[model samples]
Target: MIRSAYSHPVAEVEITELSAVPLNVVELLSKAHHPKAGAVVLFSGEVRNNNNGKEVAYLDYEAHQIMAAKMIRTILDDANKKWPLNIAIAQHRTGKVTVGETAVVVITASAHRSEAYQANQYIIDRIKHEALIWKCEYFTDGSHQWGGNCSCH
Candidate 1:
């Protein structure tokens, strides 16, 4: 269940989304375009080939969909309140994702680069810590481990 606390008119696109398909950065960026926005920032988190000295094979992501979506929306709403943003979107991928594939994308637009950059980072950081999402990493050595999306631990 996506939720927003903003009093302004909402954007045409959903603020937060959890998808099973690969994220399309181009499409998302296009949606963020605004005539008043002088700056647009995009952050894409991709699956790497190695982690903790292990040759990573791929990753499988799972989330409590309703709760995760809600958390992401809240993060975006908080960011909007803190920054003069034109548009903000956060999208996460679910299920198996191969190396080099994007797992999450955050886009933010504003009248200036600083606010856009800061808000983009803030939204992503909060989502990492607050969203109810988990990731399982598969290694080439036939081993696997599961952990929360947050890297803080």
Candidate 2:
């Protein structure tokens, strides 16, 4: 959505069509890189084996896909406003995600390291806080819990 040519050297909002397919962090990182950019920061969120004290079997993610994409774009826009980023991308997965599989990936590119790193973190944090995506964790012992309802902080 950033109209400025300099603001958006590369920008994308992606929601995986095949839930079984893993997030490709390398591809996102490559897309974020630009000749003018000195720094490219990437973040990948993966499904862990355990949450709290429970042993997680797999994660089920759900979202109003259209709304989630909109929210992600908005978060990217906010990052653009706060930083001098040349490129930004944020992606998330839906349906079942098993342990060790990537659930989300975010990338940011800028002329400086500070802005790239800061904006990358900001984008992911905002997505977690504001995006409509929800996750349900299925434990190995036949227990389940809503992930969005809980926060680390």
Candidate 3:
């Protein structure tokens, strides 16, 4: 499914909602694939219809595009330092996202599953925490709320 090849080991950072999350899982996997890589982990964050019992209509995301990419790259660098990863990628979508649509994707490849899984988790957690991205949840009942803090909910 990889339509094209990538030259970099890390392919993270994107801000757009123009054509859906055009990220090809196969392509991401292939990008991380290596002769020595034994595991590849991928995470997809999708928009849901409900949040905490509220009927959700859609999610609107905004980001300081340049800052977001910079922060994401920094997170990836930290992950690389922590794990023996072959390749890793993280991408987020901006603009309006509807139910069942993917809002973000993260992939990690390593020599073992443990490293790949942990790195993937670290990358996502950092992106959510450090990136300058904001999300607004619009409810079906004609209301909306901004969320992006470290809210436990």
Candidate 4:
């Protein structure tokens, strides 16, 4: 998941993960809703218990706030240039999160379904790959490993 704490004008993206995800993603989509916006796309990333052969106890996501927000905004800018988007909202959780919890959410509103679809994919992909977020897996065996810190996982 990506770290939250961003404020932008193009997108009203207030994110909180302090007591688990506090807002509804559907609500965020509704904010982007408009008569002209015919389509809205949403994505949710959840915590899992297992990765590969190891049992994951939980996950710790860390990020540089300024850099992450900048990267996300940049990705959104690029996506809007390619897709006719009306509004976009993306959020990812940080700190320790357990199983079955929501770790991230992305919502994209557009004039057409195609634009929403492509923009949704682009936003999530860019956020996961370039948002300066690092995830450490706390294993059931009391061991831990990190991912998304470097090119080599």
Q: Using Cα atoms with residue i matched to residue i, what is each candidate's TM-score against the true structure?
A: 0.91, 0.86, 0.82, 0.80
Give the top-scoring candidate (lDDT): 1
What lDDT is reached at residue 146 by model 4?
87
Sort all candidates by lDDT, best to worst.
1, 2, 3, 4
Cα lDDT tens digits, model 1, 1-153, are 334456654355654479999998898888988888899999999999998788989999999999898788778888888987888899999999999999999998888999999999999888877898888999999999887234767
Q: What's the lDDT of the predicted structure labeled candidate 2?
A: 0.78
Better of 3 and 4 by TM-score: 3
Give the residue spans of candidate 4 off by over 4 A: 1-23, 148-152
Give candidate 3's error at residue 136 in angstroms: 0.4
Candidate 2 residue spans exceeding 4 A from truth: 1-20, 148-153
Which lDDT tens digits does candidate 2 get at residues 59-127?
A: 999888778877887788788888988888778888899999889888888899999999999998888
Better of 2 and 3 by lDDT: 2
- Scored by lDDT, model 3 comes in at 0.73
lDDT of 4 at 64: 83
lDDT of 4 by residue, 1-153 (tens): 222233322444454322234336667566667566788888888878888788889888888877776777677667767776767777777788887777777888877898899899988888888788788988999999889223434
